[model samples]
Target: MTAARAAALPGSEAPAGDERLGEILRALDEDFLAVLGWDWERRVITWPRQHPVIGLPDCPVPGCPLAITVSTRPMCGGCMERWRGSSLPLEEFLLVPKQTSRGTGQGPCVVAGCGRPRVTVAGRLCLAHHVQHTSAGLRVLSLEEFLAHPGVVGHAEFGPCEVAACYLKAVSGQVPYCEAHLNRLYRARTAPGFDEAHWRRTDKAICTTREVSLRGMPERLVAELLYGLWVRTREGFKSRPECLRPVYDRLRARQVQQLEEVTDPAAHGHGREQVTMIRAGSERCAC
Candidate 1:
């Protein structure tokens, strides 16, 4: 489900509903029944199909309803295994008459806003995003650009470290360097002619952890993120304190000064989450 939709849910934002105020009831499928009593009805409940957070698409081969195995390769796992040895060009392979059987299940695509399942566990992509990765030389930098949001930074936004080329996320509100940089600073504080400015330019970035530095990021983007965070914490459901590095990286590359400017569903995952938080907080403030 979209972040906005998830945040808007009665239980998603806050676990409050009329069902909790009435008599207790039970269903055969006890899963989430108590939580969803307010919205429940007598019916079969097939998950994912009824409400899949993201979906997988069918293979490109005509008359094949089976899903493709790889997003970039544009074929089912069975087909992909066969194509590797056939050595037939992709176009020819697609045109050639072939049959496909039901393949194995796949996980959701990694591209944040994409709604398709990945072809394989290793590639972690949907068909459309895979095409972009292959044709456009896609260098996805945003931590949130994919479904796996890298949770390395701290809850508070401390901006980037001051060390040169050391693009580690600053963990402390007072200190300007990341934990690694701070330790390095402690070791070299008294070295000859070693000042903060000189160190920033002289040192190379040492990315040992899953952290991302916002040192060179534009101020406008940072401001947007800060404002969004402020709104998110008001009440109801709030996002994880740790922001995605790829999310900021993607926004920076796009030169998006504001989150509202983004529209593409696949690229709008972060923005969608922000919208839900803002909307929920607004509702709380009005009450």
Candidate 2:
């Protein structure tokens, strides 16, 4: 090795002009990078809500932005209910102007020991807790006093939802599905070719996260990704999956089979800096 290259080696001090990243990457074996990268890849497999590949489709109404809680619904729950109540025909009713504000989904109840899904935003309590709070004996209880001594707790989770892709907990121990999937099951019961067994495997997950999938990515691209992922971690740079997601998407979009094929590594959005670092490492590699 040349004097500058030798100086940048692991045991030696890196010279001022030498970018030590090259030497650092050179020291990491292919096997090491591959194993670490795959581990990180698996950890990031939980796809984010509204992810282009795995996310649930939104309500189909002309202006509705809310996601369809039930996959079988033609419109949002609110719009569906409104249409059912109106005497107007489907086409005419759709034409009528209606305010469309996307809904913020409910969360677990506020009571200290309660984990039931809250009934409404205002109540911030599950149906069971709401009933108890409204009863004559409990009417005078202060919010603080009730929170401190909330009687009888419900389970935080029954189990992971039955759908293979779904990560949300089931609605309750007795319920076979989460609330969203339960609604979907009822609506689709009579639909032609609807089968619970197949549905369990095919249903999309319905939760928010920052994860992504590396499935179907070409081999060479995965090689580059793994190598780059290792290099970034070694360099004290952030290796967030959300940040790397765009890099993976763009490379896959271009059908990049090899790292050398990436002519403009700076163009990958969000993770441009990370890709650039990867490109620099690729250049240093003889392979």
TM for every model, in the order presented, reads 0.24, 0.38
Pick out the ten consecutive residues of candidate 2 with the lowest summed lDDT: 40-49
Compared with the true structure, model 2 gives a TM-score of 0.38
Each candidate's lDDT (Cα)?
A: 0.43, 0.55
Instruction: Show where candidate 2 strays beyond 4 Å.
Output: 1-106, 120-123, 139-142, 150-156, 207-287
**C-alpha lDDT of residue 137 in model 2:** 79
List model 2 lDDT by residue over 80-191, tens digit each.
Answer: 8988999988878767755644333346778876667766434567767777878887768776666666463554655656764444446666766767777777887778
lDDT of 1 at 105: 28
Worst 10 residues of 1 by lDDT: 42-51
Candidate 1 per-residue lDDT, tens place, 20-130, comes to: 211111111233322222122111111111112212345566644345323355876566776788989988887775554443223455655544444443456654555
Clashes per model (N, Cα, C within 3 A): 11, 0
